[model samples]
Target: MGLIHLPTELILLILPPLSESDLAHLLRVHWSLYDIILPYLYRRHLQGSRDSTGNGRNEAKGFFRCIVTSNTAGVQRFLDFGADVNAVISAAEIRKANFRSTGFIPWHDTQTPLNIAASMGDDTLVSLLLNHGASVTGSRNHQDARRAVQPAAVDALLSNHESTLRLLLRRASPLSAPNMERGGLLNCAIARGNLPLLRMLVNEFGADLNATWQEGVYPLNRAVVSSGPEAAEIVRFMLDKGADAALANGGSSNSNGDEESTGGGSQRLLDQAIRHGTIDTLRLILGRGVVDPAIQPLDTGNNIFRTWIIERCTPETVHLLHEHGYFRALDSSQDDTLMIAVRARRGDILQLFINSGVVVDLNARLTRGGSTLLHAAVVRCKPVREAQAASSIRCTTMPSPVASSDVPTVRKIEPEYSREVLSRRCMSEKVEKCAPEEIVRCLVRGGADVNTKDARGISPLDLAEKGPEVVYRILVDSRCE
Candidate 1:
């Protein structure tokens, strides 16, 4: 008699001890065996091999192994037998499977087989899974489902698996999901400068071209800050799709009650483009006619132009802004310009300002501290590495000095001035090629007052006491009284 004709109890008892491969052989032997054993195999697969604790499920381990091995037939068998397509790979299972090196993290503890396929850049497997109803929305948690789809889609795009990305986008589930942080799928595509996938998302998937993410940043804003030749094409595509080039986050809600801005957004976009040094993106934004070429968005506490100069952004980017008249939008106060350059330790930008015919008030005292640019530069000068090393050694050998009430406490400078100085120091870790001495000479040549003092009577020479000997020598040689 056929095994199928045997008592159900006999078949169930016999099947429990067989391996997955053995079951596959039996499945081929008869359709009756396939019907009886397939569901049983699926149930066992779902239950997984229990550990000593008998409480843990390693379903994801087998799934991960199947993916790593690219055993398409093995995977198909599991799916055909009704495996939970959306089951998550736990961090523990990932470790056990030796896939730790792949850097896969459980997305909300619900990373599906499809996410793994996408991340592995397996277009065929990804297609196969999607065809089998593998969800792009991995988990069913309504709140987390949307967030989960984003990372998976991003992985496919970042891996340059265009076919996989296209498959995910073709699914209605991913299309219906909300955008995640950093401007969601469209923004992610723009950030990677993937024009073809970007086009597919907009034209085929019907992705909302104007969707905003954290801080109400639009995809256009993200594109403006991204690097790559495809950036220009992506920007054009976004613009063609009726993206608002001037949309700004005014810290208010839109009609949809999502945090978004209808006005003043373009200026912020420009600032980001400058900050990231994307010259092509910058040109695209300016040429759109939404943002006035003359509008200068103040860097506020931190001058974006000064930041660009400090980071040594391409001269073309700086010159483009200057050529378009955006550079003139900076605060007209000469002291502000010079002090910004000095605080940034950007002698290059400072010189650029001078060469651009911008007036430099070398001896002008800051509004709050009453300290000249020279005083600020000297006080902010960090000691050389060798000096710091020697000082560290001396501290280990010398006894600690007790605090004395007789010692005068250094006066706290204005909050803005103190903040600017501290922020610059915290951001830059490496020493610059232009020494404090060179900066001092630059200021002196520009007619800075060598003896200029702040409101507390701290002169440039006095501030030099806190710096290296070279700084002090430069100040003293400049004839500080």
Candidate 2:
């Protein structure tokens, strides 16, 4: 027996690495080696107990530390000494170990050896203990890390040298849960706006896309708020991967799980994109068949930006919306794009619509009946007012009429009809819809009719009956009486 068959201790001292199983097998093979190495192993592990205070720390008897930091050979030789395999459970196991320290445990604050190792992201030590059936789920550092891995942990696993992620997954541990943080994985991606990670979780791990379905919301809704061009692409991926329009539609599904409304689910997504100024994401979503010329968002999707672009609009976004097939001229004339822009109050955007030759139907206004541009403008106004105001008048070149007053000059009547908006008013049910007298006065200045009755069939004066005499008096002074 040459050097190849040297004594076991000699073999371990000379060999570079030996596997844990080999060590365990070696222990069973030679009773003599166990006697010689056992005390040595005990002395080596004693160092791990220096910080531990109790008897568990004082016991200081384990084989776990010998193989803990070894590449392989030392582990086998140490195990041959009949070392306690699960030394990670003891303090004596910690000091002798070469793995990183797990942080302070939040629960009992008793930092276990495994806690020290795991927080350091040492995959080898983790593997060694896990192979020896070490407790993987015990409280280690903070409960956050002890119980679960957060984005930071995920980042560490993916970017760092640690292989714990694969280990956790291989062991089939829970990837995430709602209360942990950011509603767990899918929602975390949504909140962080990490499109690529979102794709991975959906396609690779099959994360629950509808985890927060109770709120009638989803990561896709959040995607609309994202600014990236690929944000829409991410949404499309989610839809293809089984994202439900019903799940994203708060207005569509009631608690009963039936379709309450139809057709503009994707349109709402696009409209929200416009509202948020997420043009890139908007283009990507519009590329889907949902916003095809054959199908339109109609009113809910009838964005004010489109209205403005139709009239005085032309911006990179408008051009992009057009190229992306958001709107069609429908003839040389019936373009609704500029109309959308005007209503959206892109007054600067209105210029784009006019230059592009978008036709403005004078009667086109917000559903409540202001000019279309004004309707869109009101909704787009920031720091919302009683009626957030935004408007632009659109007119075309009339064929230069023969220069003569006798030619029956046509006088275009400005819209002056005003309905009191009582949505924010403190008025009672009967008079609640009544517009404020001050707003009524502004409307009057803009040439609105003070006599217009709301659905309640009462004029502004009748609605003001409950107010101080000044309420009725304002309307009267404005000549609304």
Candidate 3:
């Protein structure tokens, strides 16, 4: 029987229950049914419907599936059937819909079909969507629409879909389409580490290379903090485009319409770059020849060196900054760098400062406790078995001591090293061991005044009494007096 011969009421009843695939097959039964069922099929596919098994159709999922599978025909058909190309659900509505719990929603709230297509790197669908006037920036009323689309484009770029990202950018309205954080599109590119996207945004689209967004974070700072292979290239590009490397992060103006102080932000940029371990970025910033090496935070009262040392910077990073002449800018009298290193247990960093050709006053007392680095180190050093073993191994490997004119002074000694110590020492002689001796040696070699006392007049040697024997012996051998 011809499908057209069926009663309209009966056809409507029969069509509403059929799945999209089943309806597509029915199209072969009668070409005349195309006009009647085609719209219904498109609607079912786009809007999604529930079946006897409680399975339901989700408009967002249906759209995303079409894009991911490269189902261009399906996507086009939906758009042809009056699917709002820029349709979006607000984040609140999506949460209310409970789509997340049911696994019905595939895309984020405020994300349109174009956003989904772009994120999947489907250039074909993306082009199709744009050609159909799909808004690059989804619903204006939805505050997060721009935020949603920007990251989607960034995700496309991150997926190496340069063409799709370009297409999105060409349609992107810089005024409205921004990252979720309200960071500009350029910042998005920077955060994603997409050099191609970043270049295109700047060179082609005239994106502000140094535009500050989201709490006044600069694109340069974002790029520096990101772990991208082309980070250096991106930074150089921004610099060549007149990006201000010295412009501090969070460089927003005050309510008085005056340029807010740039001190803290610039200092923070250096600190963040160091913390992120982006040596190339650091070098690039330093190469700019504009950043103040002595930039310190006004609010926190921290200099770059103090921040770096207190943050326990890695040996390589410490060496990098030291080589860059950062140590000279530090106010050594305020808080000794060596004291900061000792407090953080960063022996390697301490050595870097010592070997950097900078005059380190090892006897300099910490501003807070008036304690020397040696005093801090000894007080913090715990008794580990490795130290005892290391001491015994050193004694065994050394030649027997020769008689000297300098007689050892008899001092009241604790009996903590009794028979247990003797037994462990005997066992340790057979094995090579490692301990914090390297730390002790570094301090002593730096001319750390072991006899220098804290505010309470407690000397490093006195502090060492509570520490391991290996540390005590090392201090004693160095001749504290």
Candidate 4:
């Protein structure tokens, strides 16, 4: 009798001793052999058993490969053969094997079959595994003692696998599970700027809009910093749905220390909105009237206008804040807006302030070192001045004359670049290099005292002498009397 004439019972007996590669080859041999071998092959490989060499891990990997490939029948067959629906695979093991199936496991977490399936965005496999008694609760990472259960729903949410998430949510109560454990799913959606997912989680699944999403953050705060076309839309949706605009970005009363006691943290929402959000988002938050834009809270450590917003925010954002009276509270302090503009080398912003009728008190000492505005301007321009001097020295022999209009001057500088910007920016472009000469001249023309000395008895001209020769000449001919 030929090998094809072998009985099914005999084939089953012979298959147990065969290697995986041989079984795979045999599976393609004949249709009759395929049915008999397929079940035995999956059953043998997916027994969910382990050994020292990680053969069981390879088996689990093969099973997950079927899930990723959308081989529903293969997955179903493995489950029928008594594979653990909640087979825990360490992220380390998956990583070591260099496993990738067109899509990655969302969290790189220790995961069950459902976690990987849900991340694949295949609701079919998710349903199949859930029916096979897969635990909807999260899997614990045994690799780390302090690591918490990484919820399967987070994997789906992070991947934007909405249908798969809906299936998992049906089997798992999102709130009771680890979905809301650390960084809540609602906040995750906000950070991703997925307004549809944000709406579904809140409207359908009851994810709290004002809930403490992260340790020290609320969803609205997350939405503010989350940049995308949908970011402002998400903020508006959250506020419209009753997210408390006045709730501190620092979360509950305990997070703000005494700010909640004195109603100080509420004022920072406008500041954060201006610093990080678009004009529309700023308008939305300002429209709430939760915090007064004109009133600078005394307890807030840093003034908003004095911060990097001049160098970081858009002209529109700066204008919106100005329209709301952000610069109205400027005082004779080191941290005033004009002094900050000089220190940051923001010629455009300085011009904007000057045109807006904001007084520039040039002789007033305005830096921590007790340097006047002129001293701050010259000191901050040192690096650029040195670089320019080196460039001029290198090109002196070749002295290529150019048209004045071709050069970027203070009058032509555009306000761009930021301190902690959300948009993509080239690091080569810096605020300090933008119209350094014009910044100095503007203060000088505004009657900056050339003879004014700082608390250290160091005058602006004295500081310029240590720098390149160009700085000294500029100060020597200062328009100031």
Candidate 5:
């Protein structure tokens, strides 16, 4: 090996990228990888593979890898030449561990060789390192030619330590602080959705059940995003570990985590699950009862419930929330959601709310003075007919109309309220605009006076000027007396 200067080593590093040789050659620069990398790559390639598929082919292919492992002969010879299997950059560790948090890892964001090996399905190389006494406990073992183990690296070691992984539980600190990734190896295992691995992390490695990760996310949050109830149990583990009923789901402090943009990753994951219409995941998470609903990202103003609505959470789920007292907060003196739904012309969802005990005024609008859901639809500029169509909810189609066996006790709501609901909807909804006649008929049905106008004198019929005059004529023809 004619390799001589630090500059030559740097040049050697650059040469791999420049040369036709596979990139693994540069990684082999680490004396420790001499025997380890090669056998590991080979073992992985043949880990679960079939017969006659011997060393030659995989060895040749691995030679062209980004992190090259050599032939067994070369590896054994290099090891025979006396390479240290464990090279600790002690200074790097001490500075990193002391200056930062106690749980800092020198290579926190990057994966360890074992992690990469595991990720690539390399079981042999994995076992090889374990056999050779490679430091299996931290991110890396550079001792500045010294020794120390931060909690983060210890977690890494345990994460990859097949036998030691689950047995290290007694070593875990109960400070509620996790190393490296907040929730530490436990979240990683949970994120990977490995029940056995998570069990090992919990029962043996001593991972904090309530430890938060990346953001203020917990293992339960990660598990719930998935479809299975198995993930939900991670939260239960925390609960068993003396975690408080409320750890997270929404709302977070930067001191405990990093500052996320308004509607950041946490919000997005929850939103995506709804957006994709996975009610199973939603129900599983909501059923767990630990998530906080009040943590609205102040900037986006998109509360979790609204996100669900925007993502079109099923009517069944909405009813479940209503039953469980979620929508009670929104059912204030002026039901804003009714106005919002009206503006969007989501008469189906609106009626669902009404059926679920949401107070529906023919003119329920936000503070902006919207009138009937019809006016709201009109104001939002949706089509007059399709938008104004009521009794459109499908959930209770058989009994949807709620006719008191045909009619109610004959209480008549004013058409002006219809106009206000429509107007409030205009202020809140974002669907297409409406034609004059459709708006007029919707108001008329809801009991609006066609000729009635606000202080400015612009009535539903007056606003029909934006469309054809026939619409106005039709409104006049059907005008309420």
Candidate 6:
């Protein structure tokens, strides 16, 4: 007779010798065995029956298994049999057991069973645990190492479990708690770009608007950097709800001076949006007119114009800043915009600065280094090999023919590599000498002091000698000897 046909009493005797994995597999084979095995598994723990090896290694495994697998019936049965609802799973215990590593659990730390259920977004298990006196605030059994309610809610949010997070909020004092003071939950929602969750937190729960999500990261700031279609909408919604665009949180947690200088709020939001965010995000922040575009943070060397130039923002972005009176603020500021432009090898940006009616000092020395626009223009030339490699990378490879008949005629089979090689050679020739010759001519005609030596005592003409012959010739003809 098969094990399924065995008497209940005989199966009960057999269960003690079988591993938990074997019991689980046996439970799946027959409904009668499932009933016989599951209750035995839970009852043994309650009865304090150690394994054959004389250890309580399987102590909390059944209870935790019920939670992780979302086995609501098993969880209810275990709890009904007076199981400890707040059972904590240590990392060591978890490692020794044959539990599924779902990756959401804090595998390195001790966590109550509720933490796992909440993180998994199993609302039925969470409700059961909470009803059975599971602390929404987490149990402090392991002292300061407790992982409970707050992290659970945050985890639910990170898992994008809207219903689970909302359920946890009802039982827990989320808004008033010390852990929620930084708006961790709200920030997580914002970071996730969950518009419905964000609205539910703010509109129903009354979460703090300006509360920093993390050190130096406010809700508005976080929304500005988030991706997805919902990100822009979130930004607009927060601004409409009276979020402070200029609110500076306590500086960043790390040693990144840029975040510290920008105050990690609206300023950093604007800076980051310009550098990496979508144009819609950039315009949304700019439309508010709250973050002053002209105020150069301490990290950008106190140069207002240096912000986007060093960031390598597109010329169109620069144009947007110009339209917003950003360039207008540079009149009182002492940043050498022209020299910065030239050094970045941005000839188009150099012309844009001149076209914008912004006065630039052609002869202004970049610090005591004595590097003028002419010196910057020639010294920062794109190397020939670097340009060639860039061109090659930009070119796509030709796809191979599938069969002899599929091969193209000579005219159709014009190898893309040939075009790529020619393109690379042309680019190599362009940058081989020095910086763009147009940049050299522009600086010379603008009356840049080509004869002026840098701190290294090298003049523009001297720097151009080994560069493109055109650049050396331009300096020579400009009477920069």
lDDT of 6 by residue, 363-423 (tens): 6676668777788788765456666877888968799887656212111111123433333
> What lDDT is obtained when candidate 3 is compared to the true structure?
0.61
How high is each candidate's TM-score? 0.64, 0.42, 0.69, 0.73, 0.49, 0.65
Model 5 TM-score is 0.49
Q: Which stretches of candidate 3 lie over 4 Å from their true place?
A: 1-25, 33-36, 43-64, 89-107, 142-155, 175-182, 249-266, 294-308, 329-334, 364-371, 382-437, 448-467
Per-residue CA lDDT of model 4 for 79-194, tens digit only, reads: 88767676676665565555553445336445667777877788888888888887676655433323455567777877788887777777763643344444667766776667
Q: Please give the lDDT score at residue 377 for candidate 5.
A: 44
- Candidate 3 least-lDDT 10 residues: 407-416
Q: Which pairs clash (backbone N, Cα, C closer than 3 Å) in model 6?
A: 433-467, 433-468, 434-468
User: Which segments of model 1 are wrong by more than 4 Å?
Assistant: 1-64, 99-109, 121-131, 142-155, 179-184, 227-233, 248-266, 277-280, 283-293, 297-320, 329-335, 360-433, 444-481
* Every model: Cα RMSD to truth: 11.0, 20.3, 15.7, 9.6, 18.2, 11.9
- Give the per-residue lDDT digits (tens) of candidate 2, residues 1-481: 7643577678657423545455455546667655544444444555444344522333232333333343344454444444333333323223334222322111111333333344445667556656665454433333223233232233223322235544544554344644334455465555444566676666667787666633656766765655443455666677777776554644366678765556533355555555552555555666664344445523224555444334432255566665655544422235455444433334444444344543333224324433333223222323223234322344557898687543111111111222332121111123111233333333334433445444445444454444445545655666634
Q: In model 5, which range of ten residues has the least summed lDDT?
A: 407-416
Best by TM-score: 4
lDDT of 5 by residue, 1-481 (tens): 4433344445434432333234257446776544444444444433322226432211221211211231334433333333333322232322333422322233333333333233333345444444555444443244232233333333333334444442223333222333333335655555544566666656655666655656656555565544333434554555566643334445444676753344432443344344432354455445664432444221134544564372244455555546545565333353456555555445445556655544544443334443444444444443445444633643563556644562222112111234333322101234333443444445455544555454454555666555445555656666634
Top-lDDT structure, candidate number: 4
Score candidate 5 by lDDT: 0.43
Model with the higher TM-score, candidate 1 or 5: 1
Model 3, position 11, has a per-residue lDDT of 84
Compared with the true structure, all predictions reach lDDT values of 0.63, 0.44, 0.61, 0.66, 0.43, 0.65
Order of the predicted models by TM-score, top scorer first: 4, 3, 6, 1, 5, 2
- Could you give candidate 1's per-residue lDDT for residues 1-481 as a string of tens digits? 9777998789999998899899989988888888888778766865664445643334536656676566678788777765656655554456556664555443333356777778677877877887887766545453323334434575676556777777676665454345442445676677666788888888888888776675567777777655565556687788898886656413356788555544444357666766652566677666776455544533333365555544555445555666666555333252265666676666766666556764435666666868777887777777777568777778455778977663111111111223333222212234354665677778766667777778998888887777788888877877843
**Which segments of candidate 6 are over 4 A away from where they belong?**
1-38, 46-59, 90-110, 140-151, 180-183, 212-217, 225-229, 249-279, 293-301, 304-312, 329-333, 359-372, 379-466, 473-481
Q: Candidate 5: misplaced stretches above 4 Å?
A: 1-77, 86-117, 120-124, 139-183, 213-217, 221-243, 249-278, 291-317, 329-332, 344-348, 355-357, 364-370, 382-462, 465-481
